[model samples]
Target: MSRDRTRTRERSGDAGEEFDAEFELDSELDPDADEDRTRADPDDASGGFRSRAAERAGALFAPRIFIAALLVTVGALFATSTFIPLPGAGLAGVFAAAFLFGAVLKDRRYAETVLSGALAAGGSAVLDFAVVALFGGVGLPLVAVAGGLGAVVAAVGTYFGRDLRKGLTQDL
Candidate 1:
């Protein structure tokens, strides 16, 4: 059995020979493919243009600054609700809060944006749920469904905003 195994190993090693595979390169290339290789004009300061929203979406994130911005936004929301007495403020505040949170804390990464948006929207939904339960206006089912939708909106909005930041960074 040992001799047979050794013979099999030797046969396999002999069979496993290296071969250099070669292929002919294409001597003729499409002219259209080469056209895209042209460099931008030296005089043009901007190498290429991306949307403004994409540019600002790339802003740096500092933990301290993010926390401060969030606190300010929360305070503003409370003040706006108490002193301003604006209708539809609750929904607006939620969206605005998430947007502000994302604007301050979100990095260019989509995952981070999504996470921030989800947290903001989730917080807003919880608050909305509590208000509804206390006030006894909107039903529980409606609140639940709307909360889910709001969360989705917040995440999508944050992602787009962050994506726009990339272009903004390039401009600066």
Candidate 2:
């Protein structure tokens, strides 16, 4: 067999012998090397899927003015239902006022307005139950029925109120 020769370097450590190996540098890291490498566009944020997802997630928690308004309206409704029972006649006006207020001054989203109105109605119902429990002899079943009716009425009225506002705006 013909003699073969190849230069190599090795070091003997306490554990074992280690050989040195050569590694090639990437073209991008080698400044002196001429090569074409694609770079991302600085203004192209739309290319990232997470960017759009993050924006949508942020929109869900946007501040709403109607939440405080709902609580105040609920308290007022409770007082009315407690001291002045008018065969549910006052409920219509209260719900209508709340809906108009939300439609005109608060967030215009349909779901938000309807939910606020529903919550206000529920709060009024709870207050009615509390008053009855403390002072009156009405049964729990009756209180639940009344509360459910109030919630339904409020939700329906609020939906119509928002629709009316949208219609008026479209007409003008």
Q: Pick the candidate with the highest lDDT.
A: 2
**Model 1 over residues 50-139: C-alpha lDDT tens digits?**
333345544444455445544544554455556656643544444565555555543433334333434444455457567665577665
* Span of 10 residues, lowest total lDDT, candidate 1: 1-10
User: Runs in model 2 with CA error above 4 Å?
Assistant: 1-63, 75-84, 87-90, 105-108, 131-147
* C-alpha-based local distance difference test score of model 2: 0.56
How many residue pairs of model 1 clash at the backbone?
Answer: 12
Worst 10 residues of 2 by lDDT: 32-41
lDDT of 2 by residue, 1-172 (tens): 2223345677877758788765444544555332222224445545444665776655543335446546645665666666777756546645765666646753444444445555665555556467765567665565556556655666666667667777777855
Over 4 Å off, model 1: 1-80, 83-87, 106-139
Error of 1 at 62 (Å): 14
Give me the candidate number with maximum TM-score: 2
lDDT computed for candidate 1:
0.47
